[model samples]
Target: MTKLDITKTNRAIENLLETTENPRHRFMLQAYYRHRYLEIAGRYEEIFAPEMMVENPVYHFHALGLNVRLEGQDAIKNLYREWSETGECVMYADDEEVAVSDHMIASKLTGYQFKPGKVLAAVGIDVDDENAMYIYKASEEMVWPYDDRCRLVGEDVWEVDPDKAEIIKLDPADVITASDARTMLEPLIKPLPPYDEAAMRPRATAR
Candidate 1:
């Protein structure tokens, strides 16, 4: 894992936004910037958790303002019904018990709030309703790789595709700067420290 220079990356993005003119170009730039932003924010690694593997598979869905994680074949059946009935298929980790409504899925998934129609102005983006589109598009591009633990192991892993997983790749683009981003994003996205280290440390033995 490399460190990232979040400060420099953020400033550069701001600078690019300030000078860019064309809306289409600006949109692409913003997508790239936001992608880097999420990368710096460590959204990719946490969501993927490549180091860990899941054993028993379970599927969960959030819709109609309800959150449910189901076990066995029935889980998929319920998820399909929900999607067919409501046209909502946004899913999150079943282990976390996170409610879809509690946090904006875009922000949760991407690590940046997409406020449409509001321009930083300083960044030169119209940012109005287009912000929604930006986020949706970016989310579509972001990918994650689930370990053995994922319930839908054989299916498409939205978070792991190259187009979708570009954020993770950002770590290797620039060594020193990337490390900084990793350091910063790790706390925000994966605040909890690894338990294995603590569990493995030698305990004081009684004399």
Candidate 2:
């Protein structure tokens, strides 16, 4: 995947939503787009809004021969909060394969995570200066399951090609904390209609 471009990536999701016609698929995509926007803004509450996800959502994460399963909203939210404390930002590449169905959506893409050198080193990455920043690029596959109401059930993610992952040291001048990125990107988020289960459901047709 190419270098991370936050503006381009968010715009691609908007374009996809505009071109997609299926109601169910559109519901799922809307939820996902909102999730992505809020995530970059570090708005965890909005990302996990009551109408957007189930009560006991689960997350399966796999990487470096380690598998961790987090159950329930609090667990997942805390995990994200912990990552935020380190001031990291994640960018999803727009040129990736995506498949949407009635109850699930799957995608394979290369993702880049920008983290401070301290955070990277704690994860076993060698760093010359703890104050420096680095980018970790990896191939990622995600499976998102949605309930009948279009609420996300859970996320199943895998770092499929861990061996190919690259850690690149960033130039000092290019370094930006996640907090700064949130401020820069929050303005790009657009408001959408609240999630309505009745509106998203398929209505019965006349014979």
lDDT of 2 by residue, 1-207 (tens): 233556555555567777888777787887887777677657777767777899999999896345999999999899778766665635546456777777888887777777788877777877888888787778889899988778889999899778898888888666556676687778776665666655567444212
Q: Candidate 1 on 107-179: residue-level lDDT in tens?
A: 1232221112222222344343422212112232122222211112212213322243211221223333323
Candidate 2's displacement at residue 51, Å, is: 0.8
State which candidate has the highest lDDT: 2
Count the clashes in each prediction. Answer: 22, 0
Which 10-residue window of candidate 2 scores lowest in summed lDDT?
Answer: 198-207
Candidate 1, residue 129: CA error in Å? 50
